[model samples]
Target: MKKIILSLLVLVLAASCQEQQKIAFVDNGQVIEDYQMKIDMEAKFKKQDEAYKRKTDSIGQAYQLDAQQTQLKLSSLSQKKQQEGSQQFSQKWQLIQQQLQYEQQQMEQAFSKEMDSVIKSVNKFVEGYGEKNGYTFILGKNAAGSVMFGKEEKDISEAVTKAINDDYNGKDSKEDATETTEKEEDK
Candidate 1:
Protein backbone atom coordinates (compact mmCIF):
# COMPACT_ATOMS: atom_id res chain seq x y z
CA MET A 1 0.00 0.00 0.00
CA LYS A 2 2.85 2.43 0.78
CA LYS A 3 4.57 1.49 -2.49
CA ILE A 4 1.40 2.20 -4.47
CA ILE A 5 0.95 5.50 -2.63
CA LEU A 6 4.56 6.51 -3.35
CA SER A 7 4.18 5.61 -7.03
CA LEU A 8 1.05 7.74 -7.29
CA LEU A 9 2.71 10.62 -5.54
CA VAL A 10 5.71 10.47 -7.84
CA LEU A 11 3.44 10.40 -10.89
CA VAL A 12 1.48 13.41 -9.66
CA LEU A 13 4.65 15.36 -8.93
CA ALA A 14 6.16 14.53 -12.29
CA ALA A 15 3.03 15.61 -14.10
CA SER A 16 2.89 18.84 -12.14
CA CYS A 17 6.55 19.51 -12.83
CA GLN A 18 5.91 19.53 -16.57
CA GLU A 19 4.99 23.15 -16.84
CA GLN A 20 2.24 24.20 -19.19
CA GLN A 21 3.70 26.76 -21.55
CA LYS A 22 2.15 30.22 -21.73
CA ILE A 23 1.02 31.52 -25.12
CA ALA A 24 0.44 35.13 -26.07
CA PHE A 25 -0.97 36.96 -29.09
CA VAL A 26 -0.04 40.44 -30.11
CA ASP A 27 -1.90 42.73 -32.50
CA ASN A 28 0.85 42.90 -35.08
CA GLY A 29 -0.88 45.88 -36.61
CA GLN A 30 0.11 48.02 -33.66
CA VAL A 31 3.48 46.33 -33.42
CA ILE A 32 4.22 47.31 -37.01
CA GLU A 33 3.78 50.95 -36.10
CA ASP A 34 6.58 50.65 -33.55
CA TYR A 35 8.80 48.44 -35.69
CA GLN A 36 11.55 50.69 -37.12
CA MET A 37 12.37 48.52 -40.10
CA LYS A 38 8.74 48.34 -41.03
CA ILE A 39 8.49 52.12 -40.76
CA ASP A 40 11.41 52.56 -43.15
CA MET A 41 9.89 50.08 -45.58
CA GLU A 42 6.58 51.95 -45.51
CA ALA A 43 8.31 55.23 -46.19
CA LYS A 44 10.09 53.70 -49.16
CA PHE A 45 6.82 52.25 -50.42
CA LYS A 46 5.12 55.64 -50.16
CA LYS A 47 7.81 57.29 -52.26
CA GLN A 48 7.55 54.57 -54.88
CA ASP A 49 3.77 54.89 -54.93
CA GLU A 50 4.01 58.63 -55.50
CA ALA A 51 6.50 58.20 -58.32
CA TYR A 52 4.31 55.55 -59.97
CA LYS A 53 1.28 57.83 -59.70
CA ARG A 54 3.13 60.67 -61.33
CA LYS A 55 4.33 58.46 -64.17
CA THR A 56 0.82 57.11 -64.79
CA ASP A 57 -0.61 60.61 -64.74
CA SER A 58 1.96 61.72 -67.30
CA ILE A 59 1.03 58.81 -69.54
CA GLY A 60 -2.66 59.70 -69.23
CA GLN A 61 -1.98 63.28 -70.18
CA ALA A 62 0.06 62.14 -73.20
CA TYR A 63 -2.85 59.93 -74.28
CA GLN A 64 -5.24 62.86 -73.96
CA LEU A 65 -2.99 65.08 -76.06
CA ASP A 66 -2.68 62.40 -78.73
CA ALA A 67 -6.45 62.10 -78.87
CA GLN A 68 -6.84 65.85 -79.32
CA GLN A 69 -4.20 65.90 -82.07
CA THR A 70 -5.93 62.98 -83.81
CA GLN A 71 -9.23 64.88 -83.75
CA LEU A 72 -7.64 67.87 -85.43
CA LYS A 73 -5.84 65.71 -88.03
CA LEU A 74 -9.06 63.85 -88.80
CA SER A 75 -10.91 67.10 -89.59
CA SER A 76 -8.18 68.19 -92.04
CA LEU A 77 -8.05 64.84 -93.90
CA SER A 78 -10.10 63.78 -96.95
CA GLN A 79 -12.97 61.42 -96.07
CA LYS A 80 -11.01 58.31 -97.14
CA LYS A 81 -7.84 59.46 -95.33
CA GLN A 82 -9.91 60.34 -92.29
CA GLN A 83 -11.20 56.74 -92.11
CA GLU A 84 -7.70 55.31 -92.46
CA GLY A 85 -6.20 57.71 -89.89
CA SER A 86 -8.98 57.00 -87.44
CA GLN A 87 -8.45 53.26 -87.77
CA GLN A 88 -4.69 53.65 -87.21
CA PHE A 89 -5.25 55.95 -84.22
CA SER A 90 -7.73 53.47 -82.69
CA GLN A 91 -5.23 50.60 -83.00
CA LYS A 92 -2.44 52.69 -81.48
CA TRP A 93 -4.73 53.83 -78.65
CA GLN A 94 -5.65 50.21 -77.91
CA LEU A 95 -1.96 49.28 -77.70
CA ILE A 96 -1.27 52.21 -75.40
CA GLN A 97 -4.16 51.12 -73.15
CA GLN A 98 -2.76 47.62 -72.98
CA GLN A 99 0.69 48.93 -72.16
CA LEU A 100 -0.75 51.11 -69.42
CA GLN A 101 -2.52 48.10 -67.92
CA TYR A 102 0.69 46.05 -67.99
CA GLU A 103 2.59 48.87 -66.31
CA GLN A 104 -0.04 49.17 -63.60
CA GLN A 105 0.10 45.42 -62.96
CA GLN A 106 3.89 45.57 -62.71
CA MET A 107 3.72 48.44 -60.27
CA GLU A 108 1.18 46.55 -58.17
CA GLN A 109 3.34 43.42 -58.10
CA ALA A 110 6.40 45.40 -57.05
CA PHE A 111 4.51 47.09 -54.25
CA SER A 112 3.07 43.78 -53.06
CA LYS A 113 6.51 42.19 -53.12
CA GLU A 114 7.98 44.98 -51.00
CA MET A 115 5.13 44.76 -48.53
CA ASP A 116 5.56 40.98 -48.28
CA SER A 117 9.27 41.38 -47.55
CA VAL A 118 8.53 43.85 -44.78
CA ILE A 119 5.88 41.55 -43.30
CA LYS A 120 8.23 38.57 -43.43
CA SER A 121 10.97 40.52 -41.66
CA VAL A 122 8.57 41.59 -38.96
CA ASN A 123 7.32 38.01 -38.54
CA LYS A 124 10.85 36.65 -38.18
CA PHE A 125 11.73 39.30 -35.62
CA VAL A 126 8.60 38.60 -33.61
CA GLU A 127 9.17 34.84 -33.68
CA GLY A 128 12.72 35.21 -32.39
CA TYR A 129 11.58 37.64 -29.70
CA GLY A 130 8.81 35.29 -28.58
CA GLU A 131 11.22 32.37 -28.32
CA LYS A 132 13.70 34.40 -26.31
CA ASN A 133 10.96 35.68 -24.00
CA GLY A 134 9.45 32.21 -23.34
CA TYR A 135 6.25 32.78 -25.27
CA THR A 136 5.03 29.46 -26.67
CA PHE A 137 3.09 31.18 -29.41
CA ILE A 138 2.49 34.63 -30.80
CA LEU A 139 -0.33 35.33 -33.22
CA GLY A 140 -0.66 38.25 -35.57
CA LYS A 141 -3.94 40.08 -36.00
CA ASN A 142 -5.35 41.74 -39.09
CA ALA A 143 -4.75 45.46 -38.99
CA ALA A 144 -8.11 46.21 -40.57
CA GLY A 145 -10.07 44.17 -38.02
CA SER A 146 -10.57 44.16 -34.30
CA VAL A 147 -9.87 41.25 -31.95
CA MET A 148 -13.33 40.20 -30.86
CA PHE A 149 -12.66 37.06 -28.84
CA GLY A 150 -9.19 36.77 -27.30
CA LYS A 151 -8.78 36.33 -23.56
CA GLU A 152 -7.73 39.62 -21.99
CA GLU A 153 -4.71 38.14 -20.26
CA LYS A 154 -3.39 36.57 -23.43
CA ASP A 155 -3.63 39.79 -25.38
CA ILE A 156 -0.13 41.18 -25.07
CA SER A 157 -0.63 43.76 -27.81
CA GLU A 158 0.17 46.71 -25.60
CA ALA A 159 3.20 45.05 -24.07
CA VAL A 160 4.56 44.04 -27.45
CA THR A 161 3.99 47.50 -28.89
CA LYS A 162 5.53 49.23 -25.91
CA ALA A 163 8.53 46.92 -25.89
CA ILE A 164 9.10 47.34 -29.61
CA ASN A 165 8.77 51.11 -29.50
CA ASP A 166 10.97 51.37 -26.46
CA ASP A 167 13.65 49.27 -28.08
CA TYR A 168 13.27 51.04 -31.41
CA ASN A 169 13.37 54.53 -29.98
CA GLY A 170 16.52 53.62 -28.05
CA LYS A 171 15.79 56.32 -25.51
CA ASP A 172 15.58 54.80 -22.07
CA SER A 173 13.70 56.53 -19.26
CA LYS A 174 16.85 58.37 -18.18
CA GLU A 175 17.60 59.57 -21.71
CA ASP A 176 14.03 60.73 -22.15
CA ALA A 177 14.19 62.67 -18.88
CA THR A 178 17.45 64.29 -19.91
CA GLU A 179 16.05 65.19 -23.32
CA THR A 180 13.05 66.75 -21.65
CA THR A 181 15.30 68.82 -19.42
CA GLU A 182 17.35 70.00 -22.40
CA LYS A 183 14.20 70.97 -24.28
CA GLU A 184 12.94 72.96 -21.28
CA GLU A 185 16.27 74.77 -21.05
CA ASP A 186 16.21 75.58 -24.75
CA LYS A 187 12.70 77.04 -24.40
Candidate 2:
Protein backbone atom coordinates (compact mmCIF):
# COMPACT_ATOMS: atom_id res chain seq x y z
CA MET A 1 0.00 0.00 0.00
CA LYS A 2 2.79 2.44 0.79
CA LYS A 3 4.63 1.68 -2.47
CA ILE A 4 1.48 2.15 -4.58
CA ILE A 5 0.75 5.55 -2.98
CA LEU A 6 4.34 6.73 -3.67
CA SER A 7 4.13 5.61 -7.34
CA LEU A 8 0.86 7.51 -7.89
CA LEU A 9 2.29 10.65 -6.31
CA VAL A 10 5.37 10.49 -8.57
CA LEU A 11 3.19 10.04 -11.70
CA VAL A 12 1.01 13.00 -10.74
CA LEU A 13 3.99 15.24 -10.10
CA ALA A 14 5.61 14.33 -13.43
CA ALA A 15 2.45 15.08 -15.36
CA SER A 16 2.02 18.42 -13.64
CA CYS A 17 5.62 19.44 -14.43
CA GLN A 18 5.17 19.04 -18.15
CA GLU A 19 5.35 22.32 -20.10
CA GLN A 20 2.17 24.24 -20.74
CA GLN A 21 1.10 25.02 -24.29
CA LYS A 22 2.42 28.36 -25.50
CA ILE A 23 -0.21 30.89 -26.58
CA ALA A 24 0.12 34.50 -27.57
CA PHE A 25 -2.05 37.26 -28.98
CA VAL A 26 -1.22 39.96 -31.50
CA ASP A 27 -2.88 43.36 -31.90
CA ASN A 28 -3.82 43.02 -35.55
CA GLY A 29 -4.54 46.70 -36.04
CA GLN A 30 -1.23 47.76 -34.53
CA VAL A 31 0.68 45.15 -36.48
CA ILE A 32 -0.91 46.21 -39.74
CA GLU A 33 -0.37 49.90 -39.09
CA ASP A 34 3.27 49.53 -38.09
CA TYR A 35 4.25 46.96 -40.69
CA GLN A 36 6.81 48.37 -43.10
CA MET A 37 5.42 46.41 -46.04
CA LYS A 38 1.94 47.77 -45.44
CA ILE A 39 3.26 51.31 -45.12
CA ASP A 40 5.13 51.06 -48.43
CA MET A 41 2.17 49.43 -50.15
CA GLU A 42 -0.21 52.13 -48.94
CA ALA A 43 2.11 54.86 -50.21
CA LYS A 44 2.38 53.18 -53.59
CA PHE A 45 -1.40 52.87 -53.79
CA LYS A 46 -1.86 56.49 -52.82
CA LYS A 47 0.42 57.62 -55.64
CA GLN A 48 -1.42 55.41 -58.09
CA ASP A 49 -4.74 56.78 -56.86
CA GLU A 50 -3.53 60.36 -57.45
CA ALA A 51 -2.43 59.52 -60.96
CA TYR A 52 -5.78 57.91 -61.73
CA LYS A 53 -7.58 60.98 -60.41
CA ARG A 54 -5.51 63.26 -62.62
CA LYS A 55 -6.25 61.18 -65.70
CA THR A 56 -9.97 61.12 -64.96
CA ASP A 57 -10.04 64.85 -64.29
CA SER A 58 -8.24 65.56 -67.56
CA ILE A 59 -10.75 63.49 -69.51
CA GLY A 60 -13.64 65.28 -67.78
CA GLN A 61 -12.15 68.69 -68.63
CA ALA A 62 -11.82 67.71 -72.26
CA TYR A 63 -15.48 66.73 -72.34
CA GLN A 64 -16.44 70.04 -70.72
CA LEU A 65 -14.41 72.00 -73.29
CA ASP A 66 -15.99 70.10 -76.14
CA ALA A 67 -19.50 70.76 -74.79
CA GLN A 68 -18.74 74.47 -74.40
CA GLN A 69 -17.45 74.77 -78.00
CA THR A 70 -20.50 72.93 -79.33
CA GLN A 71 -22.84 75.26 -77.41
CA LEU A 72 -21.09 78.35 -78.77
CA LYS A 73 -21.24 77.12 -82.38
CA LEU A 74 -24.89 76.03 -82.11
CA SER A 75 -26.05 79.57 -81.31
CA SER A 76 -24.88 80.94 -84.71
CA LEU A 77 -26.05 78.04 -86.93
CA SER A 78 -29.26 77.54 -88.99
CA GLN A 79 -32.06 75.53 -87.33
CA LYS A 80 -31.35 72.27 -89.27
CA LYS A 81 -27.59 72.58 -88.74
CA GLN A 82 -28.09 73.40 -85.05
CA GLN A 83 -30.20 70.29 -84.55
CA GLU A 84 -27.62 68.11 -86.30
CA GLY A 85 -24.75 69.57 -84.23
CA SER A 86 -26.72 69.06 -80.98
CA GLN A 87 -27.40 65.39 -81.78
CA GLN A 88 -23.70 64.81 -82.60
CA PHE A 89 -22.59 66.50 -79.39
CA SER A 90 -25.10 64.47 -77.35
CA GLN A 91 -23.84 61.18 -78.81
CA LYS A 92 -20.19 62.12 -78.21
CA TRP A 93 -20.97 63.17 -74.64
CA GLN A 94 -22.85 59.94 -73.89
CA LEU A 95 -19.99 57.83 -75.25
CA ILE A 96 -17.43 59.74 -73.20
CA GLN A 97 -19.55 59.35 -70.05
CA GLN A 98 -19.88 55.58 -70.60
CA GLN A 99 -16.14 55.20 -71.21
CA LEU A 100 -15.32 57.15 -68.06
CA GLN A 101 -17.64 55.01 -65.94
CA TYR A 102 -16.16 51.81 -67.35
CA GLU A 103 -12.61 52.98 -66.64
CA GLN A 104 -13.52 53.94 -63.08
CA GLN A 105 -15.06 50.52 -62.43
CA GLN A 106 -12.01 48.75 -63.83
CA MET A 107 -9.64 50.80 -61.66
CA GLU A 108 -11.70 50.08 -58.54
CA GLN A 109 -11.69 46.34 -59.17
CA ALA A 110 -7.94 46.23 -59.78
CA PHE A 111 -7.21 48.25 -56.65
CA SER A 112 -9.44 46.02 -54.55
CA LYS A 113 -7.73 42.90 -55.83
CA GLU A 114 -4.25 44.23 -55.13
CA MET A 115 -5.21 45.31 -51.61
CA ASP A 116 -6.64 41.89 -50.88
CA SER A 117 -3.42 40.23 -52.01
CA VAL A 118 -1.36 42.45 -49.70
CA ILE A 119 -3.62 41.63 -46.75
CA LYS A 120 -3.30 37.91 -47.42
CA SER A 121 0.49 38.17 -47.60
CA VAL A 122 0.56 39.87 -44.21
CA ASN A 123 -1.65 37.18 -42.68
CA LYS A 124 0.53 34.43 -44.10
CA PHE A 125 3.66 36.04 -42.70
CA VAL A 126 2.07 36.18 -39.26
CA GLU A 127 1.08 32.54 -39.42
CA GLY A 128 4.56 31.49 -40.47
CA TYR A 129 6.10 33.56 -37.67
CA GLY A 130 3.87 31.90 -35.08
CA GLU A 131 4.76 28.44 -36.28
CA LYS A 132 8.48 29.16 -36.42
CA ASN A 133 8.42 30.62 -32.91
CA GLY A 134 6.74 27.53 -31.45
CA TYR A 135 3.48 29.21 -30.55
CA THR A 136 0.67 26.72 -30.21
CA PHE A 137 -1.87 29.41 -30.88
CA ILE A 138 -1.58 33.01 -31.91
CA LEU A 139 -4.84 34.86 -31.57
CA GLY A 140 -5.45 38.14 -33.37
CA LYS A 141 -6.94 40.91 -31.25
CA ASN A 142 -8.75 43.25 -33.56
CA ALA A 143 -11.67 45.63 -33.00
CA ALA A 144 -14.01 42.69 -33.41
CA GLY A 145 -12.57 41.15 -30.23
CA SER A 146 -11.33 37.79 -31.38
CA VAL A 147 -9.14 37.95 -28.33
CA MET A 148 -10.87 39.76 -25.48
CA PHE A 149 -8.07 40.33 -22.98
CA GLY A 150 -4.59 38.91 -23.20
CA LYS A 151 -1.92 39.73 -20.62
CA GLU A 152 0.60 42.30 -21.75
CA GLU A 153 3.44 39.82 -21.57
CA LYS A 154 1.58 37.45 -23.85
CA ASP A 155 1.07 40.09 -26.51
CA ILE A 156 3.62 39.37 -29.24
CA SER A 157 2.72 42.12 -31.69
CA GLU A 158 6.09 43.86 -31.39
CA ALA A 159 8.08 40.71 -31.90
CA VAL A 160 5.91 39.69 -34.84
CA THR A 161 6.25 43.11 -36.39
CA LYS A 162 10.01 43.05 -36.01
CA ALA A 163 10.23 39.62 -37.55
CA ILE A 164 8.13 40.69 -40.53
CA ASN A 165 10.09 43.90 -41.03
CA ASP A 166 13.36 42.03 -40.88
CA ASP A 167 12.09 39.61 -43.50
CA TYR A 168 11.01 42.45 -45.77
CA ASN A 169 14.34 44.22 -45.32
CA GLY A 170 16.21 41.06 -46.16
CA LYS A 171 14.31 40.74 -49.43
CA ASP A 172 14.94 44.37 -50.30
CA SER A 173 18.64 43.98 -49.63
CA LYS A 174 18.81 40.96 -51.89
CA GLU A 175 17.09 42.84 -54.69
CA ASP A 176 19.47 45.77 -54.26
CA ALA A 177 22.43 43.43 -54.35
CA THR A 178 21.13 41.80 -57.49
CA GLU A 179 20.64 45.16 -59.15
CA THR A 180 24.20 46.18 -58.26
CA THR A 181 25.55 42.96 -59.73
CA GLU A 182 23.65 43.56 -62.95
CA LYS A 183 24.99 47.09 -63.21
CA GLU A 184 28.53 45.89 -62.65
CA GLU A 185 28.11 43.24 -65.34
CA ASP A 186 26.84 45.89 -67.74
CA LYS A 187 29.94 48.01 -67.08
Candidate 3:
Protein backbone atom coordinates (compact mmCIF):
# COMPACT_ATOMS: atom_id res chain seq x y z
CA MET A 1 0.00 0.00 0.00
CA LYS A 2 2.87 2.39 0.77
CA LYS A 3 4.57 1.62 -2.57
CA ILE A 4 1.31 2.26 -4.41
CA ILE A 5 0.90 5.56 -2.61
CA LEU A 6 4.48 6.58 -3.55
CA SER A 7 3.85 5.71 -7.19
CA LEU A 8 0.69 7.83 -7.23
CA LEU A 9 2.60 10.75 -5.71
CA VAL A 10 5.33 10.41 -8.33
CA LEU A 11 2.77 10.39 -11.12
CA VAL A 12 1.11 13.52 -9.77
CA LEU A 13 4.47 15.29 -9.47
CA ALA A 14 5.44 14.36 -13.00
CA ALA A 15 2.12 15.59 -14.35
CA SER A 16 2.50 18.83 -12.46
CA CYS A 17 5.98 19.33 -13.88
CA GLN A 18 4.94 18.58 -17.43
CA GLU A 19 3.69 22.06 -18.38
CA GLN A 20 2.04 25.15 -17.01
CA GLN A 21 -1.23 26.29 -18.49
CA LYS A 22 -0.94 29.56 -20.39
CA ILE A 23 -4.01 31.68 -19.85
CA ALA A 24 -4.90 35.16 -21.03
CA PHE A 25 -7.89 37.45 -21.11
CA VAL A 26 -8.94 40.31 -23.34
CA ASP A 27 -11.21 43.31 -22.78
CA ASN A 28 -13.71 42.47 -25.48
CA GLY A 29 -15.16 45.96 -25.62
CA GLN A 30 -11.81 47.58 -26.29
CA VAL A 31 -10.88 45.05 -28.90
CA ILE A 32 -14.17 45.46 -30.74
CA GLU A 33 -13.95 49.22 -30.59
CA ASP A 34 -10.48 49.21 -32.07
CA TYR A 35 -11.37 46.81 -34.83
CA GLN A 36 -11.18 48.63 -38.16
CA MET A 37 -14.14 46.81 -39.62
CA LYS A 38 -16.38 48.00 -36.83
CA ILE A 39 -15.22 51.57 -37.23
CA ASP A 40 -15.88 51.50 -40.94
CA MET A 41 -19.27 49.94 -40.44
CA GLU A 42 -20.20 52.55 -37.88
CA ALA A 43 -19.25 55.33 -40.25
CA LYS A 44 -21.24 53.72 -43.03
CA PHE A 45 -24.26 53.38 -40.78
CA LYS A 46 -23.98 56.96 -39.66
CA LYS A 47 -23.95 58.16 -43.24
CA GLN A 48 -26.98 56.01 -43.99
CA ASP A 49 -28.79 57.45 -41.01
CA GLU A 50 -28.02 60.97 -42.15
CA ALA A 51 -29.22 60.22 -45.66
CA TYR A 52 -32.45 58.77 -44.32
CA LYS A 53 -33.00 61.87 -42.22
CA ARG A 54 -32.41 64.16 -45.17
CA LYS A 55 -34.82 62.19 -47.36
CA THR A 56 -37.46 62.19 -44.67
CA ASP A 57 -37.05 65.87 -44.07
CA SER A 58 -37.52 66.55 -47.75
CA ILE A 59 -40.67 64.45 -47.73
CA GLY A 60 -41.92 66.26 -44.65
CA GLN A 61 -41.39 69.65 -46.23
CA ALA A 62 -43.33 68.52 -49.30
CA TYR A 63 -46.14 67.29 -47.08
CA GLN A 64 -46.20 70.61 -45.19
CA LEU A 65 -46.49 72.55 -48.40
CA ASP A 66 -49.32 70.31 -49.58
CA ALA A 67 -51.09 70.75 -46.25
CA GLN A 68 -50.86 74.53 -46.51
CA GLN A 69 -52.23 74.48 -50.04
CA THR A 70 -54.92 72.09 -48.89
CA GLN A 71 -55.94 74.35 -46.00
CA LEU A 72 -56.24 77.31 -48.41
CA LYS A 73 -58.51 75.33 -50.72
CA LEU A 74 -60.66 74.09 -47.81
CA SER A 75 -61.08 77.69 -46.45
CA SER A 76 -63.33 78.52 -49.46
CA LEU A 77 -65.53 75.46 -48.85
CA SER A 78 -68.47 74.96 -46.42
CA GLN A 79 -67.86 73.84 -42.84
CA LYS A 80 -68.89 70.21 -43.56
CA LYS A 81 -66.63 70.12 -46.64
CA GLN A 82 -63.75 71.57 -44.63
CA GLN A 83 -64.15 68.86 -41.98
CA GLU A 84 -64.10 66.09 -44.61
CA GLY A 85 -61.01 67.61 -46.29
CA SER A 86 -59.24 67.87 -42.94
CA GLN A 87 -59.96 64.20 -42.27
CA GLN A 88 -58.55 63.19 -45.64
CA PHE A 89 -55.35 65.17 -45.06
CA SER A 90 -55.02 63.65 -41.60
CA GLN A 91 -55.24 60.14 -43.04
CA LYS A 92 -52.61 60.92 -45.64
CA TRP A 93 -50.29 62.22 -42.92
CA GLN A 94 -50.84 59.04 -40.92
CA LEU A 95 -49.80 56.93 -43.92
CA ILE A 96 -46.66 59.03 -44.33
CA GLN A 97 -45.79 58.56 -40.67
CA GLN A 98 -46.21 54.80 -40.94
CA GLN A 99 -44.01 54.68 -44.00
CA LEU A 100 -41.25 56.65 -42.28
CA GLN A 101 -41.44 54.38 -39.22
CA TYR A 102 -41.19 51.23 -41.31
CA GLU A 103 -38.13 52.51 -43.12
CA GLN A 104 -36.41 53.41 -39.87
CA GLN A 105 -37.16 49.97 -38.45
CA GLN A 106 -35.72 48.28 -41.51
CA MET A 107 -32.52 50.34 -41.24
CA GLU A 108 -32.15 49.43 -37.57
CA GLN A 109 -32.57 45.72 -38.30
CA ALA A 110 -29.93 45.80 -41.01
CA PHE A 111 -27.44 47.57 -38.74
CA SER A 112 -28.07 45.05 -35.95
CA LYS A 113 -27.57 42.07 -38.25
CA GLU A 114 -24.33 43.48 -39.64
CA MET A 115 -22.97 44.16 -36.17
CA ASP A 116 -23.78 40.60 -35.06
CA SER A 117 -21.79 39.29 -38.00
CA VAL A 118 -18.89 41.53 -37.01
CA ILE A 119 -18.97 40.13 -33.47
CA LYS A 120 -18.95 36.55 -34.76
CA SER A 121 -15.99 37.29 -37.00
CA VAL A 122 -14.10 38.83 -34.12
CA ASN A 123 -14.79 35.75 -31.95
CA LYS A 124 -13.55 33.48 -34.70
CA PHE A 125 -10.40 35.55 -35.11
CA VAL A 126 -9.64 35.36 -31.41
CA GLU A 127 -10.16 31.57 -31.38
CA GLY A 128 -7.75 31.23 -34.26
CA TYR A 129 -5.25 33.56 -32.61
CA GLY A 130 -5.31 31.51 -29.39
CA GLU A 131 -4.80 28.26 -31.25
CA LYS A 132 -1.97 29.66 -33.36
CA ASN A 133 -0.19 30.95 -30.26
CA GLY A 134 -0.63 27.62 -28.36
CA TYR A 135 -2.65 29.20 -25.59
CA THR A 136 -4.32 26.87 -23.10
CA PHE A 137 -7.14 29.29 -22.62
CA ILE A 138 -8.05 32.76 -23.79
CA LEU A 139 -10.90 34.32 -21.88
CA GLY A 140 -12.88 37.46 -22.58
CA LYS A 141 -13.76 40.29 -20.24
CA ASN A 142 -16.77 42.18 -21.39
CA ALA A 143 -19.63 44.22 -19.94
CA ALA A 144 -21.19 41.03 -18.59
CA GLY A 145 -18.02 40.43 -16.54
CA SER A 146 -17.03 36.96 -17.61
CA VAL A 147 -13.83 37.54 -15.69
CA MET A 148 -14.11 39.31 -12.37
CA PHE A 149 -10.41 39.78 -11.75
CA GLY A 150 -7.20 38.83 -13.47
CA LYS A 151 -3.57 39.79 -13.03
CA GLU A 152 -2.55 42.78 -15.12
CA GLU A 153 0.19 40.66 -16.75
CA LYS A 154 -2.48 38.17 -17.83
CA ASP A 155 -4.56 40.90 -19.43
CA ILE A 156 -3.71 40.50 -23.13
CA SER A 157 -6.42 42.80 -24.45
CA GLU A 158 -3.94 45.18 -26.07
CA ALA A 159 -2.07 42.39 -27.83
CA VAL A 160 -5.28 40.85 -29.05
CA THR A 161 -6.51 44.21 -30.28
CA LYS A 162 -3.30 44.86 -32.17
CA ALA A 163 -3.31 41.40 -33.72
CA ILE A 164 -6.96 41.72 -34.72
CA ASN A 165 -6.43 45.17 -36.17
CA ASP A 166 -3.39 43.90 -38.03
CA ASP A 167 -5.43 41.06 -39.44
CA TYR A 168 -8.23 43.39 -40.41
CA ASN A 169 -5.80 45.66 -42.22
CA GLY A 170 -4.32 42.61 -44.03
CA LYS A 171 -0.92 43.11 -42.46
CA ASP A 172 -0.64 39.89 -40.44
CA SER A 173 0.57 37.76 -43.32
CA LYS A 174 2.94 40.45 -44.44
CA GLU A 175 4.39 40.76 -40.97
CA ASP A 176 4.79 36.99 -40.78
CA ALA A 177 6.66 37.02 -44.08
CA THR A 178 8.92 39.78 -42.88
CA GLU A 179 9.79 37.82 -39.76
CA THR A 180 10.61 34.79 -41.84
CA THR A 181 12.84 36.85 -44.07
CA GLU A 182 14.65 38.32 -41.08
CA LYS A 183 15.18 34.86 -39.64
CA GLU A 184 16.71 33.65 -42.93
CA GLU A 185 18.96 36.69 -43.08
CA ASP A 186 20.16 35.99 -39.55
CA LYS A 187 20.98 32.43 -40.56
Task: Assess every candidate by TM-score.
Answer: 0.68, 0.75, 0.86
Q: Single out the weakest 10-residue window by summed lDDT for candidate 1.
A: 176-185
| lDDT of each candidate versus the true structure | 0.71, 0.78, 0.84
Candidate 2 per-residue C-alpha lDDT over 1-187 given as tens digits, one digit per residue, 9 for 90 to 100: 9999999999999999998777888898888788887788778778877987898789889988988999899999999999999999989878977887897788778777877776787799878766665668889999998999988778877766766677777753334434433442343
Against the true structure, what is every candidate's RMSD?
Answer: 7.8, 9.7, 4.6
Q: In candidate 3, residue 173 scores what lDDT?
A: 48
Off by over 4 Å in 2: 1-15, 78-84, 171-187
Which residue pairs show backbone clashes in model 2?
Answer: none
Best-to-worst order by lDDT is: 3, 2, 1
Estimate candidate 1's alpha-carbon lDDT, on a 0 to 1 scale.
0.71
For the record, the alpha-carbon RMSD of candidate 2 to the native fold, in angstroms, is 9.7
Predicted model with the maximum lDDT: 3
Best by TM-score: 3
Error (Å) of candidate 1 at residue 182 is 30
Q: How far off is residue 129 in model 2, in Å?
A: 1.3
